[model samples]
Target: MTSTFLGMPTTAPRGVGHLRGDQSFPAAARRALADSQLRRNLGHATATIRAKSAAVIAEAPDWQQLRDAGAAIKADVMARLPELLEQLEAAVTAAGGTVHWAADAVEANRIVTELVAATGSDRVIKVKSMATQEIGLNEALEAAGITPVETDLAELIVQLGDDRPSHILVPAIHRNRAEIREIFLREMPGVDPALTDDPVALAAAARRYLRQTFLHTPVAVSGANFAVAETGTLVVVESEGNGRMCLTLPETLITVMGVEKVVPTWRDLEVFLQLLPRASTGERMNPYTSMWTGVSPGDGPQQVHLVLLDNGRSAVLADEVGRQALHCIRCSACLNVCPVYERTGGHAYGSVYPGPIGAVLSPQLTGVEENASLPYASSLCGACYDACPVKINIPELLVHLRAAHVTAQRRPTTESIAMAAAAYTMDHPALYAAAQRAARLTRLAGRRGRGLPPPLSGWTIGRDLPQPPPQTFREWWAER
Candidate 1:
């Protein structure tokens, strides 16, 4: 159980998960912005997704109504999360599946590792799961002497290259086909030596490599898109059929999902299925939508285990304004439309989650002090709010988190001190007029196109300040 006082989470200490970054957002973004190739990759990919999403979303006559319904459903679920979770546990248990509760990432990782060990397997095949990634499960498994193989093509590319995922839907979005070809040749053990940068050739090579592992791996791990409380059903929506294969082929399966993923009824699930695919892949519906309850007589994995993860979610739910971030369906729509994200790329945000949602969510989950710069990463453009199928109002959330960060600071910053001086000057007419007259002296400095000095230089580096007018409006009026 996590508690919040004065808008701060007191539950878990930081540094356990992937939410905090090694460097502040500005420092990381500077490096990413300098990489012209990375910008080209992101620009081309995001543009395509945005165009496709707009076309498909336009086809739905009831899109706004659906968004309303989805928002309402999420609001209800958040309000009654504890009760719904208990109901979900009971239903899953009744259907012969085991349920486990994990307070944080460490506990969840230990539970999944022990389950894999009990199966007596040294290797496991995996479905692409953000929840598992959030917990750094693959790294944890390797530390325990077990190997985890990623089955998704994008995830496989990331794994082979030993690179971090830059986009939520497309982990390797930062890499183009040529880079992927190079990675396959260098790292994929059985890859064809003649593999080309052609998409078809690259995909076939990966499929051939993963075929045997899919057939023989005794254990599989996944993350659910939604869990139905009424029927104890778990759902996974994916563009590729790999998730379906992992769900069925393995003898034992373990699923780790965020506690916020549970919806009270099947009716609520209906809204998201229609919303997720269109917003994410720009498809009318996912190519593969896998749903299962507990276990079937011999149909799927015999042993099913569901680990409901908290990992600061309870703390997020404690804050009224910040909790809406949990409504994210992992759709990259916000990313596609975010100017800051499209330009700087996801690696700059320094979290498993990125974009406008990440700017707000990561700070709240890890506490504002740990991820302080994230809140200021956005330009407050409202495109993300418009693109969100669940209507998260991401721009508003960014502002809210920024205020939280400023409030959390123990000392007054230079910006705060400057603001205070400006406020004081504005309150008195004589001081304000004197300050205006003193400002005209800057034109002398501006003759050579010089920028403000020291504290104000950072703002002027990317922009040009106009020369002050020869006379103020007040001065002109007085002369008349």
Candidate 2:
């Protein structure tokens, strides 16, 4: 990551490299894989969303066309981002929208926290938003003595329980009904201790608890799904009405959005409106769709502040192999389908972002050094690529970032030396032939393969190695 963007530390101390080789995952995966509760929760949640998403796609005959249009439009915008952004600024300003550009996470956090404080309210209601999470907005607000009350059902569950969101679409996805019941019993003041694990009971508990926070909080914070620059409008698509309450009820509204969320025209929204819901929550249309522009004449939040955050976006935009990352609409479809994420969930990634998008996007935004392990976290199965509506090519990017990391490193470790030796052997026929012959000689002629003994135990840690083939490809080639 750049040292400072618009004058602030662009990356964390551990950095993106931490994610690349962060052996931290295996420990978490081992524990979570055995957690039958986590497995059941993920299986049920992803399956339901998958079926609902399929139904929506089936209903739209032009679904593929819309996806194609969305992809093409995003590519076009990325190509001419500077010019389009200038035009966007002009259009939004002309339409009475106030746009504040933030160069890094700290600046963005400062801007939003100050805006909330200006409302002169100590508490602010919040919609479930990734951008806010990306910048750690809630923590920043709290540090400034402004309490952010999460109003979305899942967000409320996470906040009340003092937990981090493990899934993008369902922030409380890791918690089953029983866990939620326990959290409510412990955290919610008026919650009845007799509450059961029924969905109805859980929702009622959350509603009653949030209603009080909603009716009183004078400020709200949110993240946008998309912004239409042509009309200077911001759109939020959500399944719950809590997002609407947080958006409309507050006197002053502060929205923290990534710079890449902007689309050039109003008509382009039609494509995303279809793509986001089905891909994200697996719905044809979210229950609450809210839109707002600059200051609405006494209708919504009287004073609106939109912070266009460019934290690490400009750097990602500069990279040729990694730029497609910003095309993500925060759908989390990639996460839902990711096998690695399925086991470890979001926390293992160690940032606001998790799963496939987190693997690549986090490193690019946070810098490759600190999160380097993130790129290696993938099996490069290409499942994320198949699931992406915008075609992010996540697996391919993972490899590219991995190569960059190794090449930039000063020391060559055992794995690096082995890779180099293999590359050299493959390139030189004589050396490969001699090595093959030696391996064949070492192999037992007519017995089950024995495990490699200690000192060489590294090769046998997981399984016994199969005997080498009797004849090398060179020997076969000679016979032919």
Candidate 3:
């Protein structure tokens, strides 16, 4: 099921989104865990979201059936992605809209920048869009001397603070009220000086700041929750009305969406609309759900452009076991219940996509070697699988990606050598007995409940190694 772009294999695309540094997840997690404030913020936010999701999900008696349907629909979309995307492009064009295919993040950004430049506007308002973030579109726009304004409240907070989003549904979940207030005061040009940390006040201040941009911005960019292949309709679901304003107020509207976001038909939207709100914001229905079929006369944006972004998605779909990661609907339920994500937060994952989904998705999309450590970021508790509305087996994918990482290594690592040695020793009964005897002798030299020497010492830093028993299990068996 290898996906191809322009006749080239897409398993590993160049210049797709990835972490900036060589630092691995363990290093990042260590630093993040040390931040008490971050831990508190993540803990509180995830706890609240988890509780709300649980409550609403309980109200839906057929939630599992809905989940199954969502998974099936996504699977169908992935299976026929190439065909559906063609259908979608034709539909959008027939409806007087243009569609562009971007094989990677670099191409997507270039297309978007060029499109904005064509409009002769140096600024564009943006609805909260993970696709844009994944491509670093705001930075790209700024590099080209264009300003990109974020209109969503949480996205606005993250943008103003010059921080990366730590959660999917709530981008600024890492920032508390007081932190948000400080960012608003320091960064916002015309914010009230006497602003407080009250949620309503924060909302009002953000609204006041974004109102002018929403009213006057000539262009808007967005990401789709789902794109219906049958009607060429792009859907954006949000709690705030900002997405609506962005979709309608602008004369030229551009949407950047992952190719995986497409569904086969309008009927498929029903399952996702029901699944998304509950799994994400814990609401029965989103406060606003906007859908537009290409260009509309005198109603919304006259010029509609859609950039169907691959950016390693086709590569992700290439994997049989890991392809299920594409079924994700950007619901952050996996984050809410994930023990590792709650403790270390999203920055540790070092991608736009975070939490348990990120753990599997990032590595597979970018090549497991690039994000090798991400596969090991989870505790394999399977909470993510349980929480996912689309039932992506995130834990299984994590392990599969890890094996991919190991298989791709050109040289044998220390862990690999150790594993190989242990395998050989266990294969021979005499050698196994000798190894056990040797381990017991080493136990006599080392103190009980003490850290082991180098390599092994790293594992025992936080806990002591247990002393080996005097008699080997083989010796006990012989006595019996």
Candidate 4:
């Protein structure tokens, strides 16, 4: 497949407290354990990427500078988005392409559906796009009586399997060869009853299934990684030729993109194109990168429509501290490198995006006051920051969210009591030393008795609390 994701057309609330904030992320994580193949597949796939990415990144001397540049560029764009988007709309209109602005997922889907309906076609081929998935565009089109055929291989797998994407980049990361083989056997027609688990064979099976969709479907839907404002151009990079095929073959093309995707100039595309492929897929250059500015006179998609969707992005832009989360290029490098995300996988986070990015991005876009647990889902290992091509400070955002969570609720009983005692102990060193000395003497007492008193139960309950040295470190330092 050309794309890493075959995301389920997400079907939850478009509001702040959708499926995510209303329920804790753990219930979903627990349900995911029922699939043993998913566990095995995720473990094998992520481990390989983690090792390979680390090796390649370690060898690069200018990687940190590249990350800094990417971050700075994104920050500049976010700060200037209102102006850039205006410039983009003007350029697109002048170039004879119509632009549509959508306030949220509902509006975006409606705009796309209406545009397709105008074409008088009930079926369209699609390039795998997370924006469309986030807005549930396929289902909206389906409800409107339009059948959207997925052209990307992984997306085809997910569509046929009726599964939720488990990874941001590799949506079907949780499923292995045998499972894919099973999916193809059940959904795909004219499959040799003797399909092997080999990677090449699996890819060939998908290629054969999607060949007709590419040739026949007239209208196409896509999402962009970056949209150059200066020229009103849209760009998509991928490993396979499927995206290229979808872009050129269709009579009418509709591209839905986030407002944050705009850059000031075409020169900026070069920088991201350099950083994204390597950070995302460990590749020096992608096999196919398709770029189009509105439409040409006689070539490829005589009618082009661009949907600019802002589903909570404007609210996210309002927060200074959390706004950096938008700088992510959707490179799965962070998820691959994050120890916690590696163990839990993407589905555990219960959002279109999952992992460190999801932990902060979902909450900020959806509002963190309600999604209190998602921020705490991380171990704060800082691996995501280290791996981020755009240098988002994920750990710092986590700490900020943690503080916000604490302030939202009236402090828990045990936490309040424990912290108060800690405050009292730290305020008076002499008294603290005396208390410690008394507690240390308990080991000898415990030799004769069971354990310490109720106040000490919290510390001593889990394992043996070590006896203090003859004197405290402070006293020893003073003597020295």
Candidate 5:
């Protein structure tokens, strides 16, 4: 974890879009915690997901082994990413697919916008894509006068409400069925006024709304779950069949994938196919697992393009310890199990990615300075590590990012000064004893029920300061 990225830019480039939040994590979390409805919605949804995940996970005799294999494959991919990417590009080109490389969000958006423009299609159907969200593709397309219709059920909810996604897998997890019913009533065109909050009714309503768009949309945009270098294939796994429609019905398919999504072979891809579904949706397998290798003649999309997005990932990979954050398959098991995330919700983290993985990954992607508060968002309970299908050591990554943040500080803060003072006093026996005696005076403040003053008050605000004992261990030992 101590290893550094030599001759690499540790900081992400300015203006990485949705990666940076408007406010700090603490500030945002404070507001989110006060929202009773948000807490209730998140708590219920996460609890249900956790129960299902655990139930299915227990059915596997070799679940831990699967996790290990997934982790090892990711490690191998990271190590050989450059070579595999080149091989993938060559294979894809051979299969009649074009490849474009994007270094950051701005370039990525421009690439996609221009590609969409070239097709003479003013509207495109979309699968649920984190990469597209990270780059703000919908907004970009809108700006270019192209309408991007989100086909995923959850994504459709988010788009209709004009709300940012709060969860990775379930984008609208914060919305209860009642809230979703309202969104549809308000936003959906030609919707029935009597739609109830039932899941089946809601899904049917959404399906009806998207059916015409799916059949007519000439272009589609997507994100890959895994991309195979050996066969030039891209995979997308989803519970709903919306992704299947987007992949098949469109004349042109443009997939925006993070560089980390590339696997060395279809064999390596096999490990994650097993791991992702069970960990993510708590299902034995995804209902719709769609894959495409370039273009097929008179079958599916006639034109295929894959945009390999770097967007600070090169800097992330250069860091030895922080790079494992790339191993995430977006299962979101960590979010469901995270106590902090359960209460504060995904909006608090200020990224498309929320919860434990987001806490570590967002800051690293945008640089420690941009999202510094995120590293401290975790309680280090290690639940996220246990829940991760890829076995990403998220707790360990949090600590590493924290140390990186502290070391990058240009000036000493009050906490740093206080810690330094405490260290100096502890190094000397006489001074330590004197400090202990002095600390006893805090019992007076304790009796008054008033917390510490100024900068120290920050600590006391969230926690109780224990009153000093009447005598020290040394003093008691001497008396005995």
Candidate 6:
């Protein structure tokens, strides 16, 4: 028997990875909006992170310069991505690490599964990895009769609950203390019967459970935050020590990273290290910063392998305007400050990468026609752009992607016809004034603060339309 989501395969497809629900943004958002608990969880979590990020960012006087340097470094990386990736591959290989190139998700999963099989271990420990999630690696591993344990505390909570991540920095942000306590007691092995919802108790319980797995697991999988092309060093910036443990404890380590994660030099890495921590966790520096350059003789993992994934990234890089999105370091600052995301949450976007960044990236990765509503998910308030550390102009990109969606429509839509009609009317003064007179006659049939009918009703559902003025502004001006 195979599990599925909305009749589509649960695992990611061959080329571009698919969104979870397969439902459009509007449809999923309607469902998300009804979950009052989710709304409260997102609102509280986002507010706290937003405040923390702002305070720490204010402390750095050269923060803007750092942001500029980060953006410039990323831009240069993109410009020379092919060359840098080759350099990275050679460097990793020279450092005694094997490099594998996966053109798509299926290939990446196959390569990773085969590698784990060769190790003769059916169990592997994982560091927190968005790349693995994006490719649906856990499901793939499970199909091959291997168990991948999530070592990160939030990831462990999400795994135990059988839930998808709702936030970037905090995957289980949707679950409160009480909910987490229930998940731990129910799913975790050897959990105390009297476990409470207290934070310290939950941490202790999780630590004990994961400690056993960490010691036993012979294989570990991870994702890189940034891979330095110049030195072949892979960096994982984390708040918890789980990443460090996973990177060092296992005999074999396999890291799956997106192609866009590579930077040109170690100096370029310095700018991002400063930008990422403050933007993500609001700390001047992350608690654990793990770096490994391939294999070490008697130290960390003896067998190290890196899979470079290009699932929809090359396509995204081809677009001039859209490629700016690749500049994202995944700090998720935009998610913390978005008004729509606060209310609707990450699941509404239907992709692993959600919030404002998802709105732009998803549509471009999967054609705008497929995820048309995602681009319109925002209020265009420009909050995302303001909060972005790399200065991605998200609002401008949203409009651009929306235009692409309109262009892809096979036939003209009702909204398009209406907009065209209004444009034509406004262009001709005689027609505009005559239309205003016609609208004024509706004052007799219409009542103040009443809902409109049909096409206009949808707008009025949330807000009432004002009655048309008795006389036009032009008419009043002429009388004066």
Instruction: Candidate 1: list runs displaced more than 4 Å.
Output: 1-12, 443-450, 461-470
Q: What residue runs in model 3 are displaced by over 4 Å at the alpha carbon?
A: 1-5, 11-22, 437-450, 461-480
Off by over 4 Å in 2: 1-24, 437-480
Ranking by lDDT: 5, 1, 3, 6, 4, 2
Please provide, for model 3 over 1-480, each residue's C-alpha lDDT reduced to its tens digit, 9 standing for 90 to 100: 555345653653545454332578888888999999999999999999989999999999999999999999988888898999999999999999999989788889999999999999989999999889888888889999999999999999988999989889898998999999999999999999999999999999988888988888899999999999999999999988999999999999999999999999999988999999999999999899999998889999999999998878877888888899999899889999999999999998888788899888888778788788899888899999999999999989888887888889999977788899999999998999999988986575468666667766666654466789989898999999
TM-scores for candidates 1 onward, in order: 0.95, 0.89, 0.94, 0.86, 0.96, 0.93
lDDT of 2 at 355: 91
In candidate 2, where is summed lDDT lowest over 10 consecutive residues? 12-21
In candidate 5, position 273 carries an lDDT of 81
Per residue, candidate 4 scores C-alpha lDDT tens digits across 1-480 of: 546343222223444222253356665655655667666777788888877766666677887877778888999999998999999998887787889998778888888999899889899888888788777788889999999987777787888899877677778887788888999889888887898989899999888877887888888998999998999988988877888888898899999998888998989887798788788877767789999898888989889888998877876787788788878888888888877666677777877778898898887766676566688778798988888899899999988877777777775755567788879998998878877767667777554335556765644543365655777676788799
The whole-model lDDT of each prediction reads 0.90, 0.79, 0.89, 0.80, 0.91, 0.87
Enumerate residue pairs that collide in model 6.
Answer: none
Worst 10 residues of 1 by lDDT: 4-13
Alpha carbon lDDT of residue 474, candidate 1?
78
Local accuracy of candidate 6 as per-residue lDDT tens digits, 95-169: 999999986688889999999999999999999888888888899899999999999999999999999887787
- In model 1, how many backbone clashes occur? 0
Clashes of each: 0, 22, 0, 1, 0, 0
For model 5, residues 118-144, the per-residue Cα lDDT tens digits are 999999999999999998889889999
What local lDDT score does residue 131 receive in model 2, on the 0 to 100 scale? 83
Cα deviation of 286, candidate 3, in Å: 1.3
Judged by whole-model lDDT over C-alpha atoms, candidate 5 comes out at 0.91
Candidate 6 residue 44 Cα shift, in angstroms, is: 0.9
TM-score for candidate 5: 0.96
311-405, model 2: which lDDT tens digit per residue?
78887888887889989998989988887887677777776788999889888886787676778778788988887878788998999899888
**Candidate 5, position 173, lDDT:** 98
Model 2 residue 195 lDDT score: 92
Better of 1 and 6 by TM-score: 1
